[model samples]
Target: MKKPLLIDLDGVLRIGKEPSPHVEKFFDLINTLQIPSCILSNSTLSTTNDVRQFFEFNGIQTKIPILTAVEAAAMYARLRYRRVAVYCTDHVKSLFRGLLDYENPQAIIIGDYGKRWDFETLNYIFRKVREGAELIAMHKKRTWKTAEDGILLDVGPFVVAIEYATKKEATIIGKPSELYFASALSLFNLELHDPFIMIGDDLETDIEPAKKLGAETIFFNSEKGFTQEAILKANPDYVVNNLEDVIKILKEKF
Candidate 1:
């Protein structure tokens, strides 16, 4: 059997609302080769089905699996806490359907609250954490880019603020988190020692964390203007500027 593969959704498969160039070809290559793969997302704003729909709408249909931070956080929270307060968009919040408990919750699950984030909300979470509630953060991404707004702040700063106030670190359930990657491996019935490849754009969140999990990484250098020294520091197994190159590399190696 071919080695299992893990792909990042945001920068690899899709860039903002536009699909990455040649992404369809990459998926076709995987399907034709029967490579086991799963697309990983750090999006606390959307769920697996939402991602699936986006791809389908874009005409990049495939049977490959997907796991989003929202779904992972819900699963993690469900396993540990009975009552939880989820902070995320309405669609994303539906994942934690049965577990939402704003009043006297056992834990506070923070995600992409968007424009709803304010002092009152932050203070509420802080007070809850002080009251001994566990803090669960979807992904601590400091910033992200948008098709309309360019680059904007993400959920990380808020999570860190709460951590600073409460003196408690929130359990991160997204990319760069060991638990998140481990959970992805489980989808393929894989163990840590099993061979795998991780492809993504971000060095800190994607490359470094996957490396720690023993995955051969392919850095999709989507953004231009990275000095050679920075790329060398990341030390990915392979570096490519496009998804079509990923297909070629996989064909040659696997």
Candidate 2:
């Protein structure tokens, strides 16, 4: 019997540049128990390969599949729009290398650029949009925590800027979008009722979407229930203080 567990990256497994406490023990337990797991992150910063390297660097042995919004967006672009003008950090830019021409792109894809956001980039994107280019965004998260600031701006504001300039909405490819969820599930060849769990820190992006897909959900509370109010509205199956609690529940349930 194969039990599927979907885990999020940011707050549940790591925070900023540091790995979460007990993450190593958690992975060891998974190996010891022989439980199958997958990492499904909403982050658009890194590619799936990069994510795998991060886990390996942290000494967490992960053979399970890794799905990220960047991969999802790429899949979406390949299916919908082939030639795209991307507005992402250089790290993320490397993922789409050779996929886009940038000479006369048909679409504008936006993601978090961190400190690289500036007037020059914005003007370039705006120029493309004015020329009738379509817009696509990874996720609409307003802000995310970083080592430099308590809360750094995310891709949401940039999406808003483009929309404000061009008056055209972006096709979202991340959480709250059923396409991404479906793509993740397809990788496991599992159905909706196949004893699956969604574990993440964000209530709206991770928990609600998984619940809508008929999967049981676990919220990894990071900000002391800052999202609890919204999560209670959706009514997840379980809520935990950290990933350790998630492991405990799996042990009892499975």
Candidate 3:
């Protein structure tokens, strides 16, 4: 049987607000091959439904399951805390419907606040954490790329700042976190050591964690920054330049 696959959505299938040129063909191959797979995105700004709409909007339709950091964080918050104050963009605030408590919260869930992250706002969150509210970060990605804006700071740096002030680590709920990876794996009823393939662009968040979890890694060498030597030293099982190349690798190998 073909191995289960864990796919990252952002750089692998989409870039910025647009779908990658070969994304449709890649999903088509995955569907034809009937690969047991799950689409994982560390996008705190988008929900699973939003991602589906994106593909549909781009005229590429498929029924592959999706799991985003926002959904996972909501699931995590609901299962643990009752009165939770979710600090995210208005787009995804509804995910934590029943747990929205800003006045007196038992837990503070941080996500992509975008331009709203100022000293006063961060200080408020810091005070809340110091006051005994558990801090849960949606994802700790240091930066993200945009089609127009180049690279911008993500929520990780803010999460780390709060951690620094509070002297406590926030429970990370996205990529590279074992809990996040395990949650995605569980969708296929697969465990950490199960034979699987991970396709992603970011080495730190996507490749490294999956490699540690025993997945055969495929580094999607789409973005710049890493040297050829750096990629080789990271030692992914396969490195492909595009989604077309990814299709080739899967057809030729797994």
Candidate 4:
């Protein structure tokens, strides 16, 4: 039986645009051992195709599949809501560009806008919500690590602002929500009992949800800034201090 590894990109393999020190070695081991792997991310900033390019540029040789929240949200909206007013970064907008018409949307979708979160955007989204638009949020992360000085804010605050103004709770589409996970799993044509593992830095979004679905999990402790104590509470199957440790564990287990 082949083991399927679900890997998270940020903090696990790379941070921002740079790859972790031992990420290449880990990929090499996966290739040498012919282990099947898939990349799963909660990022709404890029399309799946763009994510593939990012992995290619970062020296991940496998053409492994990528499943992102942006794609999942767009697909969900297409089936449920005909039109969506997305409050996200320009990068995320590019992901569902042709799929949805942004000029006038029927639902309000919110996510991280980085430093672009302003009163005007908030007011606009609130107005749409007041006009009876449904709310959908990609993820509720409070903050994320950046290449610059300190930690940067996430979409949680922005979602809060809209919720306060509209008096409506937004539907969460990313991790902790099993719908998105099931969607990714469906792409593999694999069974629930299959030997699968989820490796990620964050415990709440990556490890806990995968474990709930009966999959083995690996926790990659990248840095103190982005580390969450909840991960320890989740009790993953394996805990590695860094990306190299993943290779070591895989070698021993497989």
**Each candidate: what lDDT?**
0.89, 0.79, 0.88, 0.77
lDDT (tens digit, per residue) of candidate 3 on 1-254: 56878899988898767898788898889889888888999988898888999999989998888989999999888888889988899889998898898889999999988878899889889999999999999889898877677888999999999999999999999998988888887888878777889999988888888888888999998774778887877789998888998899888874
Considering only N, C-alpha and C atoms within 3 Å, which residue pairs clash in candidate 1? none
Task: Give lDDT for model 4.
Answer: 0.77
Regions of model 1 farther than 4 Å from truth: 224-228
The most accurate candidate by lDDT is 1
lDDT of 4 by residue, 51-126 (tens): 7777688656666778888777877787887677776777777655654655678787776667877888888888
For each candidate, what TM-score against the reference? 0.96, 0.87, 0.96, 0.86
lDDT of 2 at 163: 90
Worst lDDT run of 10 residues, candidate 4, spans: 223-232
Off by over 4 Å in 4: 98-104, 164-167, 191-195, 224-231
Residue 219 of model 1 has an lDDT of 96
Q: Name the lDDT of candidate 3.
A: 0.88
Model 3 scores worst on lDDT over the 10 consecutive residues at 222-231
Residue 242, model 3: Cα distance from true site in angstroms: 0.4
lDDT tens per residue, model 2, 178-213: 776667667678665456678888877888888887
